[model samples]
Target: MQPLSSVQYQFPLQSLNTFGIAAHAHAYLRVTNTEQLIGVYADAHWRALPRLVLGGGSNVLLTGDFSGLVLHLALEGKQVVGGNETHHFVRAAAGENWHAFVQWTLAQGLGGLENLSLIPGTVGASPIQNIGAYGLEIKDVLHCVTVFDPRDGITRTMNAAACGFAYRDSVFKREAGRDLVILDVTFALPRSWQPNLRYAELAQAVAEQGYAVPTAQQVADTVIAIRRRKLPDPAVIGNAGSFFKNPVVSRAQCAALLERFPALVHHAQPDGSEKLAAGWLIDQCGWKGRNLGAAGVYPKQALVLVNNGGATGAEVVALAQAIQADVMAKYGVALEAEPVFV
Candidate 1:
């Protein structure tokens, strides 16, 4: 067993999380390999404590000091593992930066991940959140997930279907799979790639940039530019990108809302539902550029809640709740937060 003495107590986490909230964990371990995970799980004392599997810390809100063990996943590696007749298989260790991974794939001439460029977080967290942007989601390209089961102290692989991916959710986020820790992710990039410009804004941006037929690299560059313009860099301003999940409502509910809100922004889902833009709803409620304590809505984008400076987790929660209340009261649609509160 890995000695408990290796763990650091009262470890600072302000720098770990993108939100920049000042917080600490009772015990912290920097996991660089799967053996470390096995060792930790095998230790009875460590197993008894609550655990937080932390990656890039982009999708978490630290409500306060964590009274449990924080396993900081720092494992890193990525490569073009192999290729078949129709696709190229690329695998990345869980802790590799998400945006960097996308860029890396593009550098290797992979195209499928271009539309998901510039998303913040680690590749490991991608499946957990089913992170998406510009109409492309991780699930669209994910081949499989490798995980470590603490209960059995065994490492295993699960195909994409087994992950149970949905919009901003997966089996990993639910109670049944909470104890399974992601070790790495494999993506299957199509060989006969075509640009995905299904999203109107992305298509318009490409046209404006004079790329009648954008290459994968060009699409990634465009995506990076778009994200840079709207979202604040976490290093500059603390925030989790797209603080709320775009609520999915039935077609009838959307039609009634459209009647009441003439300019409501919504998109038709394949399942006959309507995905309402949470940012639009919040902006309509006049929450954009608004502040509640040190937590405030981003001036350029209402979907983002930023830490103006010295914001606490409680303060961010308060601001989020306020926006949710206003949006629900006005549109009768409940907005769910995308970030997990720790």
Candidate 2:
């Protein structure tokens, strides 16, 4: 067993988080294996303190220094465990980089995760947020999630149905499953590969690129190109990708809004609900390229909030609040931030 003495005090976290907020943890442990998790939870002194399980740190905003024990999940590995008639089963550790994992799957001739290419964070965080992009969500390909429960000191596997996935939400984010730490995720990629070009932009881009019948790798490449043109790389400029979820509203509400704002951008869900484009709402509120303090809305994509330079978590939160307030005032629709504020 690794000793608790491996834990460090007041660990700096500016580089860990994509937002680049200068925050520190009271105690930090770089967990390279499951034994580290068990060790931390078994110790009474460590267990008494609040805990924050961190992955690639792309999906979190550190508003201030965390007083809890930061368990930085660095576990890594991925492989094709098995395959059936219709799908190929692949398993990846929670700490594996998401985009790299998706690329690895494609490199192995798998197809289901192509549309989700270029998404940030780790595989473990994928199920928690049900991360989606272009036209695919993690729930669409996730077969099962392995989680460790500190309460019982037991590891268990839960299927997709048990995850309770909705738009950018899962049981992992709720009270019932919050205490369970993710270990790994297994994805059932289709054996009979097909390109998922459901989004018009992706389809159009593929067409423009002269790929009438695109392969999974080609589709992934296109998605990657599109993302690079719109989103800022965290290494160059700090950001948490899309800052808000596209708010879903009832059909009638959509119709009413459409009547008033004919140019409103929305998509009709299969469930008869309307999903409005959060970027469009924020843009209409006249927030594009606007800055409050060191935080600013990305001029190219209003859905993204960027750190102009050395932005504090409070500055980002304040900017998000202002955008939310503006959208609510003009469109009567509330915008919800996507990142977990820690």
Q: Per-residue alpha-carbon lDDT of model 2 for 259-309, expressed as tens digits?
A: 999999999999999999999999988999999999999999999999999
In candidate 2, which residue ranges exceed 4 Å CA deviation? Answer: 1-3
TM-score of 2: 0.98
**148-219, model 1: which lDDT tens digit per residue?**
999898899999999998999999999878889999999999999999999999999999999988999999
Clash count (model 1, backbone only):
0
Scored by lDDT, model 1 comes in at: 0.94
Q: Estimate each model's TM-score.
A: 0.98, 0.98
RMSD of each: 0.9, 1.2
